[model samples]
Target: MTEVSNKTAVDPVERAIRRIQSVYGSWNRNTSVAQMRSDWDAAFAGCTVPESCRQASADGVDGEWIVPADAPRDKAILYFHGGGFRLGSIASHRDLIARIADASGCRVLAVNYRLAPEHRFPAALEDALAAYTWLREQDFKPKDIVLAGDSAGGNLVLTAMLSLRHRGEALPAAGVLMSPWTDLAATGESYLSRATADPIHQRSMILALAKGYMGDGGDPFDPLASPLYADLVGLPPLLIHAGDRETVRDDATMLAEKAKAAGVDVELKVWDGMIHVFQMFSEIPQAQTAMAAIASFLRRHLRLEAERVR
Candidate 1:
């Protein structure tokens, strides 16, 4: 497992972030509806993709692809952005996606899936399945593609893999999940202790989002929303990254155990100290270190050993 943690000294980026969060902002997932919307808009407002990157669409699908300039010989990354199932988009994660594309030597196709409180569990699940199927229909071989996501997106990646397996389809070559929310039940002990450490999510925030998304639709442990309940048998090799002090630390650890128990090849990495979605802060020293860990993990499973060497 790659140690996807940014455990370095504080820098300007971290210092500025600390300042903002210390006074006006908060890492708690319980921001007001208006404030959250504003933050989300600002997060993705001025994103700039590379010139070689272009917009791509598949037939009857609702997502786009971020094709890199120098196309790799053989590999593709189907990336999913994280916003607790309620917010976030491909545009919001352009910089991170670019890094993923460059590191994996694969075209990164990020999703702008439907959100929660408006669109529920199966909606995102359905979108993920549709996207995977569309990618396959476009001639992407199972072994040529990899599925990766962060937070809620991570959960969806697994759900999609399980659904594809259930439908008797081929799985991706590998999968990367960062700070995944595997357990919507919020029963993990880390959820309590790490609540203070988690910058963007807490039990209260999750419960609120669940209420908005579930809205009496079904149980939170329906195996789709919270993949920890699913039978994760015969899945592809998985690499999970978590922060030891984060709320979902145990979530990753527990999911690793469950997947291992099911005989699936799984690796779980716990970083020393970081916050939820810490991998996004590329400017931070620890974030870069964490991204390298993830890159190494993907290389190991995908046989792209020439990556870092190059």
Candidate 2:
């Protein structure tokens, strides 16, 4: 643990996140997905699971509903998890989704989309679309829904919107992204520049995961696979959050710039000295602050009236 006693020392939040990165920094595609999921669960052992939720499976996607006590029934969040498209499930991300649920004061539907090497390319996208359609079937209006995710999940959130647009389907009110990997081609300059600085996520590992997800027939530049190359016009308002220390920093920055150039309402926030998906470290103060910012953005865009209990 970093010294929190010194006044001029690094912030405790920074220290905590760095510690987590150090412990799991070497983790990569070599690790079995099962073990990775187990490790993820252990990393968040301190977090309390949010209250009043149920598990359900429908339309070939598995998910859990996170309904915080006193949450509004009017709006909902469709959440996806991040593990480079190979690992991560609703179980690995339950607490994170629960935190978002608590902060947004709305129910969160976290999808366990199909993983790669087994299911490739459009499989996860199909699942996300299915989950959103299921939510609509539940009577949730398009504008009342908020799509949110981190890392690969963030990429899926963006691509899913593109998929919807291509199909002429309705869109959600807004989208929240955390350190999204918009380019599977790994073409961003930050990938090389921030490689040493980012405590987690190595370029080699990222490419390997991308290969697994892309399979033999998939193209990295496919708009649905890598939304960075996609047209951004007519998309919903977007709130993108990325840490300066992340290797994918340019992914978010470039995506935001491209989206803005294409006339989308985009708010990009780059936090100084933070790493990829810092929001996963709920014990970190910056993580808490970022979640609060997400809540404010969701509230404003969703037009939500309910205040968080915290």
Candidate 3:
């Protein structure tokens, strides 16, 4: 249960999510990437922000960029966009990533990682870890960065954290996950029970995406694919936000339990009646409110220097 008071109605978020699902019911990766992106554009229509407040660079793979407006130079956020690692592009998540930059008071580097049914496993992971390596080589300190993502991107962030830790590199100050699909095995009982309940994600669709991403090489239980299977001994502080109603809610809950058992400081916040990645959809007031909480958590955990001074 959420201990924090939430002022917005959860019903609107649910309705909006269902509306989106209706518009793109159980889409497959067989659609042309162009069509997939265009569909996302149509679905996310009507959201507008100030130009001076949001800028992007497309020179990287697929419109990936470092947003500067309302973006603080003192701190940075490395964000991964979620399309279940099969069907999303940076263009689809541009507005939402900008919101993260604004709320977290940091410069945001939105990564357009490779997708599946084409790139397959380790490709997205390689792209994500490469982004981190590139940022650090550019003089960005690990301690100055906060890693964040939604859905499959959330799994990427956690695995990237572990990858860095295993290599003896310093870890990021914090990590933020929104409705992470950390368990790809479809083991969560909610995967069955909550399929119809979850408006945005259908188990059939996700299982297909998961299979395509897994390819034929290794098990989905591999830490690179499912961070829940990894040893969580050396990661930084983590903040996970999940909707109480998502099919993957059990994923977050299990990961949190494991992290706590491993003696890691994990703050898992479950939003009552909300759905997946609602924080990125401004049409929902609850999303905006959730972003506020996420931003506060990032600042508090990542601002270690300030905390020390205090």
lDDT of 1 by residue, 1-310 (tens): 8777788766645563574365336435577655665576565444333624656664454566666556664666888888778777776677777776665555777777777767777888887887888788878888888899998889888989988888888899988999888888777899798877666567887777766666675688878778898999899999898877677788788999999999999878787876667777666677677777777776666665466444
Ranking by TM-score: 2, 1, 3
Whole-structure CA lDDT of model 3: 0.77
Q: What's the distance in Å from true for residue 128, model 2?
A: 0.4
What lDDT, from 0 to 1, does candidate 1 have? Answer: 0.76
Candidate achieving higher lDDT, 2 or 3: 2
Clashes of each: 2, 0, 0
Q: Across residues 155-220, which tens digit of lDDT does each residue of candidate 2 receive?
A: 999999998898899999999999999999889899899998887777887888888999976788
| lDDT score for residue 122 of model 1 | 80
Residue 3 of candidate 1: its Cα lDDT?
72
TM-scores across all candidates?
A: 0.86, 0.91, 0.86
Candidate no. 3 TM-score: 0.86
Name model 2 segments beyond 4 Å from true: 1-31, 306-309
Using TM-score as the measure, name the better of candidate 1 and candidate 2: 2
Among these predictions, the greatest TM-score belongs to 2
